[model samples]
Target: MPAEQQHCSEKSAVTNSSTHLPVRAEWLATHSEMALDPALPVIDSHHHLYDRPGSRYLFDDLLCDIRDGHNVRATVIVQARSMLRADVPAHLQPLGETEFANGVAAMSASGIYGDARVCAGIVGFADLTLGDAIRPVLERHISLAGGPIDTGGRFRGVRQSLTWDADASLTNPLYPTTQSMMDEPLFRRGFAHLAPLGLSFEAWVFFHQLSRVAGLARAFPQTQIVLNHCGGVLGIAAYANRQAEVFTHWKLGLQELADCPNVMVKLSGLGMRLGGFAFSDRERAPSSDELADAWRPWIDTCIDTFGPDRCMYGSNFPVDKGSYGYGIGLNALKRLTAEYSRDDRANIFWRSAQTFYRLPESSMVMSSSNR
Candidate 1:
């Protein structure tokens, strides 16, 4: 386990030592800031829930962060390949995760956990490489997502990550993807199932692979594709110290994807250790100003390339928690988008995700403070 990926699962604790645990909560307390616009509605478009030996961020941990000051009304939990059924057939195993997340969502919708709705939109994982054979699994996951939440549908999409790199260090192992999996015939055959079912696709790929995503979007013009983590911009490992070269390539790739109208981008996830900013290396926690400054070059290019409507904010919490506190991450997003009109800000903050995931407007409990 990497030091930056501290959130754990039961399996990780046995193999990894305690040093890989997430940054201590006490360390994050070294710098704190009140939410800049506390009343603004938010939908954490991408995040995960898991429990590891020394680290955990289940429902309670997520709710604690929601209450930390941002008006995070709801969140769309992306798949982290957790809580899978051990005994089930390989194709049916992901059903366990959908059941687990939907159960948490039912708990949230009960209103017992305050105004927030966690896991309101569940993007469970399914092996697209399974090709057309994956239809039954996708159907079962959708059925599990059914509950009294909102009629727009709780199960929104699938995220296989597809984060491949020639650098062996960057492989997540969890995804088990072959290089250029998106370009594979079997993957495309499985991907063909999404739009017909009205589900979206979450593309988590490296910056170098943006052209692959654009190819996918062009192939399936009707399917909604979200490019995760600012196209998974990377700076660590073999990519270290070549910031200028990385940015020029990343920006060019983003420009090509921007032309694919079916595609959108998530403007968060810069906090990961893979991002190479090394904010966590500092003696004190980073202020929102520092976060905003460090994130601007990439974020601004994303917003400018995709526009606010085609982009949404995702905290990528717990995964990002290793880099900065939840409140500070969102506060920095607030600082970055302060200049946009109220409507544009609203789209980036919550509405883009709300509409993209088919989550109902009722899920957002706006503060009286207004935008």
Candidate 2:
């Protein structure tokens, strides 16, 4: 069995709401390595900043990671039920997240945060199952994110999490989802609004569900879809002791999803307990090399199938923090792609995210050490 990993177990009295396996800061500190390429610019394509009942990872927590040593110049904040509005109608509540993220963007834009432009692009959440009623909600989100989409809105897109599974442990009951959630007519109708608004979509489905994502991509080729967490690899519960089977299914899914020209993938999240790394089982936090070795088979396959142009790196932080530190997590990514051409590496590092999210020009500045 994989190392018992915890995530957002809010129901657990001893643990925080935001952390699954509470990160052992002291254990992680036992081994550390500086950024592999300090000058190589990066845009952390996907990260969440949520303040749950027992957990809090706000702007300050993220800044600490940014200060850890990577040359991350900009970031795209993905939605995670963060800073939601309590006063608004149920459907209109997501707008508060956009407002919160954009406010953070404004703070980073002020230059006081130094080189990093936090939340340069924001991906807010809205239940697409709401169908056309979601249009007004999306408009309000766009408004909160700052401006018009074609003219470069900081609001990049929408992510209605589709992660689901038969095993109870593999899924999150907090967000009720189904195997056919993607195929629902009402969901499709709401999703249709994205392309017209010039907005992109982020899919956070599991490996077994990647084929469904492929179908959705083909159904809406005009809309840009970015697959999250390396297509949501599974390692616990029914997926345990079956790495070979899981990898085979995952590879086939990757190939099928890659056939959709409209879809892209993020090379992140393998550090999570769901990924079955079981690094947490060790007496100490795993080193970057260990992470790189365990992750290479998965991350390498993503780049191989999707190519650099359609691939970007995301920290998937705080969630994966249970397995490794921010710097170490990124170092594993850097080490995995150490042999790629500089331009290709840049795509995985920052360019692809900037392109996909329509991030600002400030994030495009490449440092002299970008070799």
Instruction: Give the clash total for candidate 2.
Output: 3
Q: Residue 235 of candidate 1: its Cα lDDT?
A: 86
The per-candidate count of clashes, in order, stands at: 3, 3
List the candidate 2 regions with Cα displacement exceeding 4 Å. Answer: 1-19, 150-152, 365-371
Candidate 1: RMSD to truth:
4.4
lDDT of 1 by residue, 1-371 (tens): 22222232211211132112255555676777778988788999998887666656688777766676678988999987678888878778888889999989999999997989898899989888989999888888888888323454589899887888897567776557777789999999999999988788999889999888999999999999999999988888888999999999999999999999889999878987788898878888889999999999999999999999999999887777767778889999899999999999999999899888888766776655553
TM-score of each: 0.92, 0.93
lDDT of 2: 0.83
**Per-candidate alpha-carbon RMSD to the true structure:** 4.4, 4.7
* TM-score for candidate 1, residues paired by index: 0.92
